[model samples]
Target: MESAIPAHLTVERTRPARKSTSFRPPYPSFSARFDPSVRQVVMAYFGVQHRSATPPPVVSEALAHLASVGGGVNRERAQYVDEAGYHTTVEIRYWTDPAEFSSWLADNDFWTAWPAVPDAGFFLEVVRPTVPRFETLFSNDRLEGVAVAADGLSGEIQEHGYWGGARDRIPLAQNDLLAPIGDVSARTVGDLVTVVPNGNLCLIRSGQEWTETAGDERQMYLTEVEPVLRAGMDFLRDDGLSVGCYANRYLRVLAADGGVTDKSFGLSWWRGLEDLETWSESHPTHVAIFRAALKYLSTMGPAARLRLYHEVTVVEPDQTRFEYVGCHPRTGLLRALG
Candidate 1:
């Protein structure tokens, strides 16, 4: 769907974390995991507007109620996402009945009830929802690595971080898979994916896996073990490890039109990528070991490959500076996004 917000004010971004070109569902798409009970979605773009007098509590309450106001059966999750320097301070997003949009305004008393926040330079924020008219172009899913030991806390830890907007958690610990990547490229990306109190993101790992023969049980087991995921989490639990650039997955759940894969995506987000080094110095231990495992597995045989993608969003500036369209620095052509 075309965006309802004006073109100039919207801040668009992308990630390079998703690259699952290898392992796709045997069918065109996977079966739907969560039943589609909530059909309508609403996206709210939030800005600081009046930082001094703005009532954070009131705003918070309004957001909380917005989820249930529409009344759907599907587990409607609400998340707030923000990227530093982006025009919008926060983006409160959710899905449910479209009709409730009116109720959201009335119950919240948005008319005159908005915190007597300043009006002059309110920093101007916008909240608009737009569904993709065509299909979405990405896929996302949560694959639990090997959950070796049941800390009984894995679920809680994941929930906490998932809700907190801490996009990726490996690099801080120097995940096992980092050395091969960081050492080889250490290339920095100018993008990031952050989760707010209620936001979420996704990851992707793909490359030519060794072809399965009639009988080849001698494959590397550590990389495919289930406990590894928990191991990664445990590493995150620990404080320090080595420092290096790590890869973080980015997931944006736009309406997919089956451009990439012929399979249906699950409760996942569109794919994107991020470099751990660009934001911080170190990575968690579990992450370090985990990444290493991936690299080692890559060496074994089948060429593990998953291309990454991401986005850099900024406000519309003067038309003169509007560039990058078809203007290839090398060939100098005006080919832009269709």
Candidate 2:
């Protein structure tokens, strides 16, 4: 495919080109385009925790409750085992309008009832990032998480296939470095704990899907690329504080029957956008993952069946609410302050 860089976006031509910067993907890519009138987008995670492989009744109950409310433009379900080996079933939903999200939360009481169920851990993490504070990139046109709430996909975007593409895509990055401000703090009310975020808290949901690959391609991705990806995610989740990352969860997208699927994502919280970019550009773990991915893409060429995508959002303090009920202190964003 011919490269079609958007005229509105510019690159620093004088900078030295790395392999990623020099190589252009054979496949066309796209980004989500939000409506100009829409000011903010909300990404909410409703999760229920369990120790056993089988989810407790409240997990399904929470899922059913979300289904009944049915407010967001997009919703997805995933599960992850935390550092302590606790399993959490999560449903993530996205909304473009803050008013609609507020109404939905009010109607559902934000899963306040889940705490009453004995021994069940629950959490509600909602981030309302203004349109400019977030960015999206997809290897293919298939829409996923937050992107589904977008007005539409762009026509072959240019701000990809490069290291700083994510930051370049974010409008705020044009004028601001998007540094961390203040500090994350938590307040406890009985069994519930609410974490108040600082300014410019960065959140990223980076996903991969290999469902379309078969034979050699599938084997290659599973054996070569995924291991590196998992290692990088594990690094961020386990030893990322030296950098600005607060916490990371490598979550698996679960099937309806509670089986793990071919999909997975790394959900992480960072101090700011600059911190994330620094890690992506300089971290050895990430560099290995990037090289493996580039090799896979170049080798597979057009036939590569793996789909990659990510959505990043930097939320203001006022635009966030992270509440955990009957949950471990390390649950979700709470670990940032804990």
Q: After superposition, how far is residue 306 of candidate 1 from its true place, in Å?
A: 12
Q: What is the lDDT of residue 246 in candidate 2?
A: 88
Error of 1 at 90 (Å): 3.8
Clash count of each predicted structure: 68, 0
Candidate 2 Cα errors over 4 Å, as ranges: 1-27, 116-119, 256-258
Taking the tens digit of each residue's C-alpha lDDT, what string does model 2 give over 1-338?
Answer: 22222334334434322234346644678887776677888999888887667767776677677766767887788987888778777889888899998987787875746645555688888899887788888888788899887767777765567777777677666666678899999888888888988899999999999999999999999999999999999999888877889889899998867688899999998988878988998999999998998899889998888999899988899999888888776677777875
Q: Give the Å shift of residue 122 in candidate 2.
A: 0.8
**Tens digits of per-residue lDDT for model 1, 1-338:** 12211133223323221222232222111111112343324332222221223335544454444434442222212121211111112222323344564465456433223343222111111112221110111111222111111111111111111111123222111121221211111111221111111011112212121223122222343235224533443332221112221111111222223122211111111111223222222345445544654555455433332221111111111100111111111100011110
User: Could you say which candidate leads in lDDT?
Assistant: 2
lDDT of 2 at 309: 89
lDDT of 1: 0.23
- Which 10 residues in a row give candidate 2 its minimum summed lDDT? 1-10
10 residues in a row with least lDDT, candidate 1: 329-338
